[model samples]
Target chain A: MSSATLEIVEPGLLTTVQDAGRYGYQRFGVPVSGAIDVFALKAANILAGNAQDAAGLEMTVVGPRVRFLADTWIALTGADLGPLLDDRPIPMWESVAVPAGAILSFDGARDGVFGYLAVTGGIDVPVVMGSRSTYVKGAIGGHLGRALMASDSLPTMERDGHPDPTNNRLPDHLGAPRYGNTHEIRVVLGPQDAAFTAEAVQTLLGSEYSVSIQSDRMGYRLEGPVIQHRSGPDLISDGTPLGAVQVPGDGQPIILLSDRGTTGGYAKIATVISSDIGTLGQAMPVDTIRFATVSVEEAHAILREREQVLRDIEKAVRGAAAEAVSIRIDGDAFEAVDDSGRLVSAPAVEGRVESEATRHARVTVDGRTFEFDVEVQRAD
Target chain B: MREDLRFLPAGDQAVVVELGDTIDPQTNRRVHGLMDAIEREEVPGVFDLVPTYRSILVYYDPMLTSLPELQARVSELYRDLEDHAVATPRTVEIPTLYGGEYGPDLEFVAEHAGLTPQEVIDIHSGTDYLVYMMGFSPGFPYLGGLSERLATPRLDTPRLEIPAGSVGIAESQTGVYPVASPGGWRLVGRSPVRMFDAEAEPPSRLAAGDYVRFVPIASETEYLKLQESAVKGIHAGDAAQ
Candidate 1:
């Protein structure tokens, strides 16, 4: 007698519910907890026809095993973790329908670290200080503010229309980067860039740092050539916002992230641009990161470009065919039609779903195309 | 903050405006002045205004206003701010129980400060501290003006867990821990006051630029009683004798 949507069977490494972020409360020493790969989360939410900031599950290097309690459409993005629905492999970065009783599980991450999964309606969690993101340190927000464990049930957000949010597509160009071993994260020098010598600043940009094993949602600990500081790495303590590249006494540059302290004492050499934070977030442990400094004007320009690209994706979603279609992977293989109507290959699919009838259905099997009897369903 | 009134970009979403280089109370006042001025005017697109020790970080939506436009507005306010709108900080006197289990690192701080345990408590509660900023943990005030006699460095290796309400001293600063966390600060006492409560209005009990003092309680039972009162929505300021 409850509205539980998904029940966790195998709560893998670290899976937590997240949204855009918790804003405004950072001054109260609250971290803005959210998905590391925010762009990927946004893209996945978009593909599921949900609002860009809708709450979703963020899987870490590994993913959890969940069983659907209700029929829903879902989208997965960022890492190519071996996602399987019911037992068969499923697709990533596209909307897929899952009937009630389907069990979803992931084998392991083939690439990337964090993976985002968005349902048709967002994850229905009580927002703490205006965010669904989990700040586990505070034990607040997002499924009790910790990594989801076995037997945990997730609630689905209430929605009016568009029950089946499958078949929506995002252009590959605007999508967040998939599994990659390295990232060229852009930075805008200063806030504390003067704390370091000019040679050290050059060393920061010139040298490539590897994402250390100690990295987490709080900050990305880096291992690379130490960037020497003219003075000590301590400041009189100040507000350290997102993407602050704090050099500590150890000389390693730790790029603070979503769950970092509201303020810190370490001198920051530079800050990663808001646009490139998503890229930085997606870089897995042991991945190489090369820094490039740009002017603040250029940083703003880059962020504007990202915003424009998001607008383009939204426009494209609105411009699609009137009757939404379902791209299901039956038996084996994959195939789909691009927005331009060209035949394209697809990904794996869900375990099992027994849907009796549909308005219009198409099935592709072994290079042969099968179309179900056409039954028109119009919104107007 | 070497540059007076420097506007630094905090990524693309926020701007860090530095008031002064030093950690002087005047710099904090200026930071709070700008904060009050901005809060009163209520500029469009400015989402969150965070005031720190010597600077203010303004988080805004670039879609509504550009970096330069926000900078111009801030500059105008800085130029025109004749009256210090910064209010005299409210004084919060936290009732604390010192030494024993409540404060595990009491002896450490006592020896480090070259004072008897009783002298440590006396010196600690004697001075008034200004809430310089809040950081490290929720509602954890970064206080200024610990008595120089009680100044001590933090532990070389921090304890794995310090309970919430533990008043700690680290390198010339003293503040209560608002939440349970691993910290390097030497423990001196325990405060019954809830520094942060999500359900409470304003969330944080102590605001930046607020004045604070500690009231000494003799017994752990008194501390427990006050803790119960805090959970029931009553705070130390009201219960302080």
Candidate 2:
């Protein structure tokens, strides 16, 4: 129950272990390196009842073949890779129970450009500089402090299987992630908006650029219209953020991503809205990405809405777990299993157990059974 | 040109201070001093300030302060620190292995400098260079002050990869590539010491305003062990002893 081994049979285009991100320490010029599809990563971890920030495998378009040496619960989110649990089609966005010596394999991506595999207890990798994300350029953190190779083996740990009943609901409503050939990403004018000519700014927002093969964890090299500037180029090195669309001398826009350098010299005209960053994860080589302008206020509203949706999912999951008990349970300190099976204190006393919901139960100590009048719906 | 500053609106109560055509050292000094003055004043909404060679990019939480208020605060700081802006400098020495395989382009650099390969190494080792700034890749310093006699343009086509510690010249500037990357500079030598170790407290071996002097070594054999061990993630000091 201490650790398990994950041996890579074939390392795909790129498969690295990543956590939320390495934050702070920017003064030393360290990039905030981490997974691209954060929503999928968080969803996978939540389904397995692991910590939301737990590190997991981030597989690119070409996925890897791995063999787990022990039993565990795993959830595959992000790209629909046609994941097979013992050769049976397992649903995406749901946890799949695997027995000991199970082999999980994936072909190239089918729906999205990246996929995440989150185990119940999470990968037991050493954290460096306050994170487990791999910064390849800096060569710090994550399994042996580098990328996964063919013969690389990663150690896993026994999971407590404590599920957050609130986060267990399937996220199919967001739909199978779309990796459409052309994507229109929303953006807001950045701190350097006026640096470019008005026509150049219009071209950036109006053009449909094809993502070049040069795209990596650093940034996306986009090819489209030549955005000419009215002034001659002269840029001092400056700080830029992830999602900063920097148009360099050649006029091609490069959309910076996770693991981007701390600073840049290119004049940035706009920044992709934080809520739409997931669109970058879905873009593969030859994919087209369009930018639509939005007010900064609208961008903030979108971010808030996304955050609330994630929180609501977590709440529903926990509520469902508490509804399935049949016993007329008062606070007898009876051990209740969470969605992940780890013991947690039952909800505060005077908790009502609704009978219709199969996900949660309120057990009665003296053995009296009562069901709720109706299913309670949460207000938005 | 005289300096002028204006607040440009960036939606949702955010404004960026526009400093027109201020890409010179004199302006850089003024911009830096202004940033310092603002920090002393403790402007609201300002979360962080990133200063480059010429301009300062400020980040603030929009929920806390309005754009107009932040702009007013910056102008007040700018007007105060414009006169007293000067920075003291420091010098650092780098030991290098010149010529032979360690420096594949040593002959080319020598030819461009109108000297023999050994003489080229001497000229490079004899002079002190100034670090103008650090950019491009991490800890990759954009150095100035290479002698006009030794000026050389970058390779017509960049190499697929240049190893770390490789000392090279691109036009009038000389620098050491801190990380292995695709580069176009003309290599003339390489240093053994790690220039950009992430584990080190400072991370970068050199910083802006630091002075650099190259001290040359004749033997290429001295670098073989450090290069071999460094690539394998073992410190050269551990393997050398």
Candidate 3:
């Protein structure tokens, strides 16, 4: 049986359909709701043979219990959420097949904070304002504009002929993921760096900040040394970037995230570099983090190196053995059965339903076409 | 006295051009003007440009253009700032239902202003407003102009949730909540207009430099009907003036 749907048995701590992010909408105050650790999201998507920005599940802390109704390839990355298929421990950072009716479950995280699960063909949801990312605050985008609820079923896109993505793994040279209790987050000095006294800047650099319980997707509140300001920690409201360390009057630093407000009035003494934002995102409450300053050139070099690493992973995955069991159809081609058959639904393509006959079904499997007899049951 | 423009590095990818240290009409307008010039010239590698009260943040792809090159290019553009003509802002009149349930803190605002709710309505609606920028919530305008008399501080303890379209004042600024969310602004009215719609083209009803006029409405039933239409994209009384 070719399963094309994922039924949610448990929604985990907080699971949302996220992609690269909702871009170009920040001008109107739309938060860019993407994966906390985009590196993991990209890796998972690459392993699943989907576009790098394809919508995937971003699970926080714990992972979800999912049962597939179709054969699909999947890759898990980021935090080590102990995922098991049919009670068997599976490998992370590799594309693997999930047969129809296979139960995938996970216990609490063994390593990281946010785990990304990318399925072959990606999670198909209506693209709202140019993204599938879930910004729960505005009740916009992703699955029903909120976190995944129990018993909710997510749809996967249909794919055409291709080598099964299960023929992929994170090459050894790419290096294993790092999930440590403490992180040294690199930052670039700010647009309002002058607002803080030299002593405050030193205090920030010299002190260790722990992630506070008040942290969320919007911002990470760090509790530590009081970052004394020149006057007050207030600036005319201005556009805030991801990882901006906005210091309010309380002097505690708040590292803004992907879901941060478009503009902020608090003065940000410094901004965390893009590459370290993922590392910062994985810092759970009570996790220790210390600030380190890096030149912009160094930051760019780090980002470029990370990109090269992903490229190498993709190149290596191309040569691995196939381990996937899911059936996939091309976007241009799809499995067609009687409307009354067991497969209750699929992504609708208008005027694609050719006939009214309920006796036959045609499906494409592993690049070839096959037909099956169907017995339709009409509603009373 | 006007201050010279200063460029500040946000990160490797973004640079902020500070028009001034304070939020004034001319400084804010200059910020928006630079945004227009950047957009018109199609600054290479720029993926997003955000115009704020006194600064414009240009987020670019550093791989395509370096910060120094972009800054030099922007500096050249700023040299022509005095010659550039400002675009005429589009005016959208927001129909506000002041006092009573729509504004939970109406009395507080009136008492602070030393006026009746009716006078507060007159003063609030009488002046046209400038949208400093969009932030806080989707399509929520950070308006610059507010009547000094009507200025009220935020509630000592903010409500857990403020309904969408609740027009509030904080210090010398006034704005509406585009979506139902937790906020700390002092509410004095509610606008029936939907400030944001995910399905609409250009989601935010108001953009930076846009003009807003708060027109008062009486009936709650009428307000609800207009809100439904606003959600569907027809703002009952709004048109570019």
Candidate 4:
């Protein structure tokens, strides 16, 4: 089958193409600029069997109406959008086989603030600076480095095969990613914690604040008690990291997000844990926010557990698919070629009949070429 | 006093050291030396090395290394770094057109310095400034070592956007805004020279370890001609100067 196309009917409140993030250029003062709810974006892609970092539509508050130009497999996740297929209700958190020229319209979101749409084989957008994420401030990546507009056409790559309509289901609780709007976002006390008054620290965690209307991908300008810095001068600019809660002289806490400037002068009082950053990003304006403190060890344990869960899910998926075949290369060394034209030498594998499921193979030095049916196991 | 520097965990694997309240030249030099040492040792887990006026933030990976291990390595290098000599620095020359439309706020800065516009330019261009760091925007340098007489406060309110290549002074510090950004610094002059080029390998003409000296030119006609040739990618005339 040929590639599919999706013609946007009504562009939502805020819809943009997003990928993983921009990296490795922080030293030059460039922001990462990527998807706000990274966890949700990743899960949506994996559920659709797309690349982990594939570009997808990030719809916030309101989602767009799209009409498919060809048959494709797609999944809608993150927020609970009251979606209607030809005026008929369609459930969230499940794969849906879109027929040729079918209209997919999602109205106002009821649960979370952001929703994601992931198509199998992913959205095809030109990558800039190694990412397809839109950096609105710099106008760098994504689809022409801007938001999708009405009547814009997006092309989809070939799918693994349309997901069976019967298999279109997701966990009930996971239908819409839950948001405890008042949950204390766990954070590690910052290097500049001592620079603020003890009362300031107490006020930060104990009190509740509202996400201001000024919030965007750059940072969230929180409205609450003024966080005062006791004895720091106009600091010579320094590098700012993701989730850094910086308090400028004005006293309001601005939580820096994915597209925050690489360096800043304001004193950062706290840094939100990586696990909770996604929660903060999904919070809507006027949503109440509290703070909690977690030790470095606890954060690591949480991360490890999350990774394990992902690995388990992948394993389950792999078991349901075809089994891997093993092959061994003889005396000659095999050469591994990457997109960058650089080559690394590996042990040669013996030629063997490729399994029907094997699209690629890992050749071992002891004369064996392991069929590509196996999932990649990373050291981490 | 020989108290051990307290190393605090930032997040997953990053460590941040807060070297409390001192902007003395000696402290700044120590910060630079420590960064050089950490780079030389090549600690495996550490991915990014960021040094500021007082603190040094090191970002690392928890999977490959632990926080305590990275802290121990930093402590070891800190002790070893005390004996190293100052590394040779590169000097960057910025060609600027002082006063007139190119530097509309030049008169204001001159008045703040208690001198005529010509005398203010003389004192400002006389001293060499070090590039402390690159931040705010790409290739924008935060330079230190300004003459006390040339100190000027920023505008009462910031401008919505300032043009790129505009050089300004705020209090005792001076900097060049490499890209057009919202700023409040008291502008003194604008440079026809391009401080940043996205096409260039290094992208920035100046980096954290370099030094800078401003050279003032006369007349807008000369400035425009120089700018046109520079945009066409010329570098010959200034090198001869």
DockQ of each: 0.47, 0.17, 0.55, 0.38
Q: Sort candidate 2 into its docking category.
A: incorrect
Candidate 4 local lDDT, B105-182, one digit each (tens): 899988877899999899888878987766666667778889999888889999898887888899998888777889
Residue-level lDDT tens digits of model 4 in A192-227: 687799999999988899999999888988999988
User: TM-score of predicted model 1?
Assistant: 0.85
Tens digits of per-residue lDDT for model 2, B27-62: 555655666676777787565554555555566655
Q: Give the number of the best model, judged by DockQ.
A: 3
Model 1 spans with C-alpha error above 4 angstroms: A171-176, A320-380, B1-4, B103-119, B153-158, B234-241
The 10-residue segment of model 2 chain B with minimum total lDDT is: B232-241
Over 4 Å off, model 4: A1-8, A67-71, A83-94, A124-126, A151-176, A224-237, A249-252, A316-380, B1-5, B18-21, B24-42, B82-87, B197-201, B218-222, B229-241
Please give, for residues A203-286, the per-residue lDDT of candidate 2 as tens digits: 987778898999888888999998775564346566666688888788888888888876777777888876677777678788
Interface RMSD of each: 1.2, 3.9, 1.1, 2.3
lDDT of 1 by residue, A63-177 (tens): 9999999988899998888899988998887888999999999988898888889987789888789888999888878998788999999888776454356476776565545
Candidate maximizing lDDT = 3
Order the numbered candidates by DockQ, best leading.
Answer: 3, 1, 4, 2
lDDT per residue (tens digit) for residues A54-168 in model 3: 8999998888999998888999999888989999999888888999899999977888789999999889888999889999888899989999998998888875455678678
lDDT of each: 0.80, 0.69, 0.81, 0.71
Candidate 2 residue-wise lDDT at A116: 90
Interface RMSD of 1: 1.2
